[model samples]
Target: MKIKIISSHKILYQENIISIIAPGYHGYFQILKNHTPFISILKNGCLKLESKNVKKKIKIEGGLLQVKKNLIVIIL
Candidate 1:
């Protein structure tokens, strides 16, 4: 799956990832490749992204998340 994390100022990150863990309104959740479409309000927490060879963690204040057709977009 591909993901793009955007902020008010610029695009924070973009990459092809195997999985991502996000802080949703209720709690933390993980999204994997080919997962069903999803949308949610994000809370202040850590966002984790994993790829073939790299793993990253980003701290976000709050944001919105949308998943569709193997694409994930995070607006912060």
Candidate 2:
């Protein structure tokens, strides 16, 4: 799966990720390969990603996330 995070100033992160955990407005949620298409409003929290046995995280103030066809794009 592919993930991309962008802010008004620049692209924060972009990579082929295995899984993701995001801070949704209601709660936390996760995404993996071949998952259903989704869209959510994020709250202030960390965005976690895992790929190739490595995990990474980014702090987000708030954002929007959209997923479709194994691609995810986050705007903050």
Candidate 3:
């Protein structure tokens, strides 16, 4: 899936990925390519993204997560 995260500060990330792991308000969750459309709120925690080239980790404050049409968009 293509994961994109935007914040008031800047674009945290925008890249192609095999998976995206985020800290959901309830708990941790993973989103893969072709993930069903959905939206959620994330509490303070970390986000993990994996790709062919490298794996990434980023800590986030509260934010919004949206999945649609094989795309994951996050905004803080």
Candidate 4:
């Protein structure tokens, strides 16, 4: 599925990915293709993005996330 990670000021990462780990307000969650739609507040932690079939991790102070139309958009 396609994914775009950003912040209030700039885009962080945009690409196709197999999975992602995000720090949610309640806790951390993982998203994969065809995952259920959701909107959640985020927390400070490392975000793991499995892009090009490789897992890459990025840390953020946290913000929000929305999953819709098979797309995952994360805001930091």
Q: Write the per-residue lDDT of candidate 4 for residues 6-58, one digit (tens) a residue.
A: 87788878988988888888888898888888998888898888877588988
* 2 against 3, candidate with superior lDDT: 2
Task: Give the least accurate 10-residue stretch of model 4, judged by summed lDDT.
Answer: 46-55
Candidate 1 lDDT at 75 equals 100
> What's the lDDT for candidate 3?
0.90
Each model's TM-score, in the order given?
A: 0.97, 0.95, 0.92, 0.88
What's the lDDT for residue 33 in model 3? 80
lDDT of 2 at 51: 96
lDDT of 2 by residue, 7-61 (tens): 9999988999999999999999999999899999999999999999789988989
Off by over 4 Å in 1: none
Q: For residues 1-75, what per-residue lDDT tens digits would candidate 3 score against the true structure?
A: 788899888987899899888999899999988888899999999998899999989998889999999888899
- Sorted by TM-score (best first), the order is 1, 2, 3, 4
Model 1 TM:
0.97
Which candidate, 1 or 3, would have the higher lDDT against the true structure? 1
Q: Report, for every candidate in turn, its global Cα lDDT versus the true structure.
A: 0.96, 0.95, 0.90, 0.86
Report lDDT (Cα) of residue 31, candidate 4.
88
